[model samples]
Target: MLSIFLTIPLTMHSQSLFEYQWKNRLIVIFTETSNSREFQKQMQILNQNQNQAGLNDRKIKVIHVIPDKHQIVFPEKSGWQNSNLYQKKESKIDFEVILIGLDGGVKLRETNPVEIEKLFDLIDSMPMRKAEMRRNDN
Candidate 1:
């Protein structure tokens, strides 16, 4: 399994979003508005399983973006921004969730809330995750 804790950069920038999450899986959540019900549901599921997802060891980083409102919420803080970066990655739908692998590529996208188990299972199946697991076994 992937390691439990990894060092993230001290700074965050829209231009280098993926660069900061270079070796970590990213869970990007986009909503039409900050108060959207779907967004709340997604947050709840993720928050509840924060420690349980990703091979029982990996801790996913979550980025909540309300593009319509030009706001972004990080796990440790929140701020206002143009939303161009997130908007470009979002689907046409108003509410969407994207899972990006450690390789900095989007692995999954959903228009509705996704169960934690489903997300964990997907991560556990990744080749990189398998390699991490094997390495940990020894």
Candidate 2:
């Protein structure tokens, strides 16, 4: 159930993340640019097909939010989207990572590049995800 709902003009300046609420868990990387070192490393860590698979298994989408450039990048989308939607809401930090759950709750927040294993472990521990896995296993 890869939700590839590729709508254009990703610059919606509203408080609601309603579009991603029920369907996808989200990893939001807040950085100054696509080239930011921490951002690069974080993106690189998840660049593998297996890592991507892990994310898909958990119904997760990685989004790069570059407030300085007024852009947010969606994994399912082709290019960077011009938007200030995620700017300043989390903070003015140069780099930060946020893990959002399917229910639109902030599951984890970190000032450094996230460890994928840690992220996966947290998700796997969640009751919702445990049920999801049980259904899949059955």
Candidate 3:
């Protein structure tokens, strides 16, 4: 009788699991709310689609910025209600999606994820994305 011991490599798999490669790409931040399960499910689906589309190198980071008491101010105070992106949209009590460029500057700020495709288009049109595509084409 022969006994064999097999060791599973956990580090590599774990790294890939939590490692999103969007450090220099577009940042998609979502405010966490009581109805966060839906957003989480949507994000999971989006990640799956991205992987299937061969966009592994173009990772999208989904950040959940939980608002504190002081941070929870009325939207009307900051002209948020009048913004084009927020005018007619109705969101849950606490929810937001902020799109930021690679330089850490906010590009498109919205109160819903319905316009996420626009953010993708904006990122794809960025100079970095163009350069990366050119490099890959070589």
- The lDDT leader among the candidates is 2
Could you tell me which residue pairs clash in candidate 1?
A: 1-133
Model 3 Cα shift for residue 93 (angstroms) = 7.1
Local distance difference test values of all predictions, in order: 0.64, 0.70, 0.42
Query: 1-138, model 3: which lDDT tens digit per residue?
Result: 111011112211321211322353333334545247655654555555444253335544444434321121211112112112222213454565554444444555566553446666776787877777799899
Q: Is candidate 1 or candidate 2 better by lDDT?
A: 2
1-138 in candidate 1: lDDT tens per residue? 222122222113344454645566777777777788998888777666454444236546677776533433434445665546444643578888877777666678789999988888898889988888899899
TM-score of each: 0.74, 0.80, 0.51
Q: Using TM-score, rank the candidates from best to worst.
A: 2, 1, 3
Q: Per the 3 Å backbone cut-off, how many clashing residue pairs does candidate 3 have?
A: 0
Lowest lDDT 10-residue stretch of candidate 1: 2-11
Residue 99 deviation, candidate 3, in Å? 1.7
- Runs with alpha carbons beyond 4 Å of true place in candidate 1: 1-14, 49-56, 68-75, 78-82
Model 3 pairs in collision: none
Over 15-133, each residue of candidate 2 has an lDDT whose tens digit, in order, gives 23457776888787878766899988888777767788898899887777776343334457546655565555445678888777877667777889887899999999988899999
